[model samples]
Target: MDELAAFLRTRRARVLPETVGIPTDARRRVSGLRREEVAHLSGVSVDYYVRLEQGRARQPSAQVLDALARALGLDGVEREHLHRLAHRPAHAPRRASAARPRPELLRVLDLVADAPAFLIDHRMTVLAANRLADLLYGRRLQGLNIARHVFLSEEGRALFADWEACTLDTVGHLRLSAGHHPDDPELAALIGELAMRSDRFRRLWVRADVRTRTHGRKTYQHPSVGPLEVHQENFALPDATGTELVVQSAAPGTAAHDNLRLLASLGATPAPSAGGGCPAEGGDRGGALPEEVA
Candidate 1:
C-alpha cells in the first residue's frame, strides 16, 4: 500500500467506533470504524474519503487534514505525520549530496575519548567513528550502514538486546529520512535493498511511521564485554545537512561505564610495530610507527 493510505488505515485501526459515538454492531466486519464512518465523523463525503485513502485525492487542505486528524483521534506526532504524507510533493529534485564530516568535527570526535561516538548520515551510513565506537561495533560495522546491518547481518541480531525495538526505530528513522530527502537515489536504493532482503523490513515500511530519535537508552550484548546499557544522544551538525553525531554513554560510577572504558582502551591500542622507525627511501615500512612519532 502507498504511504498515505497505509498511514490512514493504521491510524483508523487504532480508534474504536464506540469511543467515537458510532454505534458498534455485531454485523460490522471491519476491525475499527469503517471509511464511511470516518467520513461522516469528519464531515467529508464517503467518496472523497475513499478516494483519499486510495491515493486518488489531491493534496488535502489544512482544514481537511485537521478534520481527519480529529476523526482519527491522532496525537500531535501522528497529526504531523498525516500532514507530511498528505502535502509532500509527488516528485522532488533527484540530486542528493553525500554527507561528509568536517575536519573540525573529526577533532571533536577525538576529544570525546570517554564515550562511544560516531557520525551518521540520513541513510544511517557511518561517516566517522571514534575508537570506542569501533571497538563496540567491531568489524561487523564495516558495512557502515546501520539499517543494512539491522536487516541483512546476523551480527545485528546478536548485538542488540531488544532487536525488534531497534529495527522498528531504525525503520521509523528511515521513513523520516525518506520524507526529508525523497529524491535521494542512494536512500531509495537502500530502502529497495532492505525490502528485498527482509520481510520484516517490508512490513514495517508499509506502516508509514516517522520518528526522529535523538535520545534513548540502548542495550548491547557485546561479545567480549557481555551486556551493557548506555544512554545514546544524537546531535545534528549544522555544517552537514542530514548528518548527526551520535554518542553513547553510561552513567558514571557504573559497571557499564567501566566496561566501556575498557573497550575504548582496547580499541585505542596500536598494533605491534614490525619496524620501529621510518624505512629507507622507497623501502616498504610494513607496520612502521606513525608519522607523529617519526
Candidate 2:
C-alpha cells in the first residue's frame, strides 16, 4: 500500500462518527468517517477524496491538508506527518552522517550529578551518559539503542514496570523519527530488523502512531532497587540536529530518591545477581560514546 494512503486509512478508521458530531446509525458499515463525509467536511469533492485514499492523487494543497487534519482531529505531530506524506520527495533524501553530542554537552550531562542523564540521537542511540545513568542503566546503557533494547531484548522487557506502555511510547516516537528522516538507512535497517524479529514491534509499527518523548514520568523496576520512579525530561541540544539530552530524576525525600543514592554508593558494581555493572569509577568503560549495537 502507498504509505500516505495507508496512513490516511488508519487515521480515518480511528475517528468515530459520533465523536465527530455525526450521529451514529447501525446502517453505517464503516468504522470511521466515510470518504465522502471526510471530503464534505474537508470541502473537497468525493472523487478527489477517493483518489487521495486510493493513492491515485498524491499531492494535496496546504489548505486541503489542513482541512483534512481538522476533519481527522490530527494533533500537531500527526498533522506534520500528514504534510510530510503529501510532500515527500520522489527519491528518498540522503542518509544523515553519524551524529555526535558535543563534549560540552557531555559535560553538562555529567553536571546533572544527582540524576540519570544521557544523550541520545534521533534513533535513540545512547550517545553519552552521566555517572548516575551509568549506575542506573548499567550494561543496558552500553551500545544501547532504546527502541531496539525495549523491543528486542529480554532485559529491556523487564526494565520498565509498565512494559506495554513503554512499548507504545517507543514505537510512537520511532514513527515520528521515521517521518522526520525517512531516508535514514540505519533507522530503516533497525525498523526492518525489529519488524522481522518482534511480533509486537510489527503490530505497533503499522498503527502509524506519531509522538516525541519530551517529558514524562516513567517507572523502572530496577533489579537491585526493586521499584524506581523518575520524571524524565528531554532537551534538544543546541546546535545539534536530531540529538537530545534526557534526564531522569526522582522527587526529593521519596524512596526513589533514596534508591538513587544507594545505587550511586554501590558504584560500578551491580548488586549480586542483579546483573550489569556501571562504568568504572573515575571514567567511562574505556570506550567511546555512542557505541553501536551490532
Candidate 3:
C-alpha cells in the first residue's frame, strides 16, 4: 500500500491540470492537481482519495482504480503497476522461478541470422543469444545480469553509445520487473547490489519510472565493427512467463547494416544445433549449458 501511494503521488505530480482539461490559475501553488481535483476527476470523495494517497485505505475496487488510472493519465504499463501495488496481498515472499530459454525459443533466436537477437528473463539475465548476437556483444554479457553489467562493468558501459539513456532504461526495466515479482529474492538482491555500487542507478531508481519500452532505435559501439545504429524490437514469449526475445536490426544498404554483415562474417560459424549446449555459455560457467546450442 505504501508503494501504491508513492506510485500514485509520483504519477499525479507529472500530470498538469490544464492537460487533463482542468483550467489552471496563475495563483495556484500546487505542483500538480490537488487532492480534491484528483478525487473529483476519479469520481471519489476527497477524503477517500486522501486515504488512498496516505496508505490508510484498503484495496480499492477495480472500477475506482480504473477511474484513478484515467485521472492520472497512466499508460498501459503504469496502470498495470498501479493495480499490482494496490492489490498485492500481504503474504510470504516466494522464490522466483529459474530462467531458462526453451528449446523452441532458442530455435527462434537462431532464425534471425542477419540481426542480433537474444533472450532475457525478468531479472535481465541473458539466457541465450544467437551467433550474431554472441559476436555483437562479444560474448561478454552471456549469463550476466545485464543491469549489473551496465552499471558496474567497464566493458558493459562501453558497449552503448548513449550510456546514460541506456542505463536509465535499464533502471526502468528493473523497476517494472520488481513490481511484478516483489517476492523474487534474486531480483531484490540484484537491485540492492546495484543501488549500493552505482550512484547513477540510485538516482534513476528513485524517480519511480515504470515502462516496458518495446521498440526503439539504439546506437551501439561495437568493439569490432565500430558504431552501429539499429532498430530494437522486444517480443514476449507467449509460452514462457517473464521472458522476452529482443532483436536488433539495421536498414538494408546502410552503414550499420554493412557493419552487421561484417560482424557476421567475422564470427561466421556453423549454426549451433537445435539440441546442443546453450548459446550463451561462453562467459557463464556457473551452470551446465542447456543442450540447446551447438
What is the lDDT of every predicted structure here? 0.76, 0.78, 0.80
Query: In candidate 1, what are the lDDT values of residues 160-272, reduced to their tens digit?
Result: 88999999999988988877777789899889988998999999988676778889999999887888899999997664257788999999999899888777666544222
Off by over 4 Å in 2: 268-294
Q: Over the stretch 100-173, how does candidate 2's per-residue lDDT look in tens digits? A: 55567767876898898887778777766777776676553634677877887677778889999999998998
Q: Model 1: which residue pairs collide?
A: none
| Per-candidate TM-score against the hidden true structure | 0.84, 0.88, 0.85
Sort by TM-score, best first: what order?
2, 3, 1
lDDT against true structure, model 1:
0.76
What C-alpha lDDT does candidate 3 achieve relative to the native structure? 0.80
Clashes of 1: 0
Measured by TM-score, how close is model 3 to the native structure?
A: 0.85
lDDT of model 3 at residue 4? Answer: 85
Q: TM-score winner between 1 and 3, please give it.
A: 3
Q: Give the per-residue Cα lDDT of candidate 1 at 256.
A: 92
Model 3 off-target regions past 4 Å?
21-29, 92-97, 268-294
Name the runs in model 1 displaced over 4 angstroms: 95-97, 140-143, 269-294
Residue 52, model 3: Cα distance from true site in angstroms: 1.2
